[model samples]
Target: MGRVGVDGEQRLLLRRAEELVERAERSGRAVSRHFYTPAEQELIAGAFRGRTPLTLEFDGGYEGAERRMLLLYEQGEIRPEPPLTAVAIEFPARAAVPAHRDYLGSLMGLNLKRETIGDILACPQSPGIVFAADAVCGVLYEELREIGRTPVTARPARLEEIVVPEPDGILKRATVASLRLDSVAAEGFGLSRTRMAALIAAGGLQLNFRPCESPSREVGEGDVFSVRGRGRVVLTHVGGNSKKGRTFVELTCFLR
Candidate 1:
């Protein structure tokens, strides 16, 4: 398929998400599922945007999972949890493994889309992958060959049972003048408003993973945004106004 622009991709993903929601409602089963990038997950949530009869949930097996899988269902279906299977791929010790790239490449070599898999936790002992059970669990458990420079073998496991290293990221809290995206981003990242405006105007920033050139756009709490060459941050909370009437926002910027 040809590359779709950000707007096109967002529309397409929203449509698919709604379709899944409708299917789940009609079938009365929690049988609908889709893999979503962090940004796509945000888009999907926006598709259902307010209080509705739909149930949408996300999980990547453990806390602070980056690439999450989205599960959709009606209010009282089986459950909103996607059918996930944890596959721990064991490799020889002393084998250098590029967690994300290597395991992802091997899975793609199996003709799997990146969405079919969730977080690929790279542990020194072994790396684990959370895969959508309906499509990839059996195939990978039966067929994965190698990951990067390490010979690998897979087996079924429980996510809660595994102890993996924390994700490679950091969290920081900052108080900004307002929720205007560029302004908060500027403060959190230690850039001047002029520089931030320049970046936004140059199409070097993304609001919730979609291209956003407007610096004055209002960023709500819980929105994850990125600035090219600077890294990504999540607006963890929107607090009350500051002493001088400025908006108080708390955000965590993930280190690149």
Candidate 2:
């Protein structure tokens, strides 16, 4: 997914979101846009801060989705269905399972914008589900035939057909000197402090869904650290200090 930085493009997206809300208010109808990354969603929400009586809805075709579309409608107006379509891509049982990037790469190869697509549920042994904009479903069904050399079949599916796999997480309880990003992330991800620091410096980590290059940044309970290849870890709890003065922390690691 594309990351929106503090640049012209970010400004344009925020402006567009504001325009959509304003249009909905004036027209007394619903207006929506394509999928947005978590960071972009945060920016939009912040842009509308202090604006009361605004009815905004975010949906990604399912609950707990990371990428979602934004909807703005009048207070008493009936909410319209989100312009979403679920595409199921089935791979041959004998074929190697494709990773998330592979599926995304194939879609991008079809000239689809990243914003038009939402969460991709890569099933281990079943058909993978892709939530996308309704406007792109026809192209996907017609042109999307292979995902990184793996032959596949694409078909439209109901939103309920998506089977979200259970998160595979490893629980850990460890003691760290402090709640710094590097210390807690290293202990949780089983990497050395030096390596973790290097990863953070190289833009390989995200804190709370936004890129964070500061290894010394303090972390708190519920902070999530995502490493590019190592998946993500959540600082679920903070405990009292150990005898050696190290603070105890609990983490749940979900490896990719």
Candidate 3:
């Protein structure tokens, strides 16, 4: 699924990437674009593979972020900081905790492009932090006063102030007939094989951060499977076959 077909959005993003690279090369300086999802970033990477000598760097406001901005620079140019800022939305202690989608929805209501926003970390009983482009920090600070009827105080904060919680994952070991995407994903996500296959066919599954519609796709040890509305699972290890001729596998499941 990595740049297999150039859709309109992918083509536009690729063109922007090329323009940024050309600008960086011409001016002998670093240039960057707004945030991009992992899929978009992969597309950009595939399009530029071995095609340009410029160095490419990606960074979100924090480490282990799914959405990040791309930086293009030369070998000796001084790399500029990523134009990212953190907006902390503090909910009242007694207020019901807002879901991630709630925060994102409120932001979108402000007429902001999705690309300008990064990750929204919803911390329980604590201030939720949103990583957005620096250009929108003022608007977010000024107008973002509520999320889905719950009043919240939004303020711009330094990136260092963001505190991301550790991922909570449950480790499970299982044996499957094969390492097909459906087989491993069903076991890891506690779903029936039929249901998993249907989910894949409906474009609800992502193999290694790219939407995959093939349930029979061979999955490897390091492959990650993500299902929207469910959670993410990583195929951590592949071991020897069992006595019943089933392949042994370990997975780390992160439930939403």
Best by TM-score: 3
Model 1, span 91-123: residue lDDT tens: 777777557777778888989877778777767
Q: lDDT (0-100) at residue 167 of candidate 3?
A: 84
For each of the candidates, give the backbone clash count: 0, 0, 0
Q: lDDT by residue for model 2 over 109-203, one digit each (tens)? A: 99999999999998886589999999999999999989988999889876656899887888999999999999999998899999999999999
Each model's C-alpha lDDT?
A: 0.72, 0.87, 0.87
Runs off by more than 4 Å, candidate 1: 1-7, 50-52, 159-161, 167-175, 237-249
> What TM-score against the true fold does each predicted structure earn?
0.81, 0.82, 0.86
Instruction: Kindly provide the TM-score of model 1 when superposed on the true structure, using C-alpha atoms.
Output: 0.81
Clashing pairs in 1: none
Task: State in Å the error of residue 84, model 1.
Answer: 2.1
For every candidate in turn, the CA RMSD to the true structure comes to 3.8, 3.7, 2.8
Candidate 3 residue lDDT tens string, 33-112: 47998888877787776887887878897889989999877778788688988888988999989999898999999999
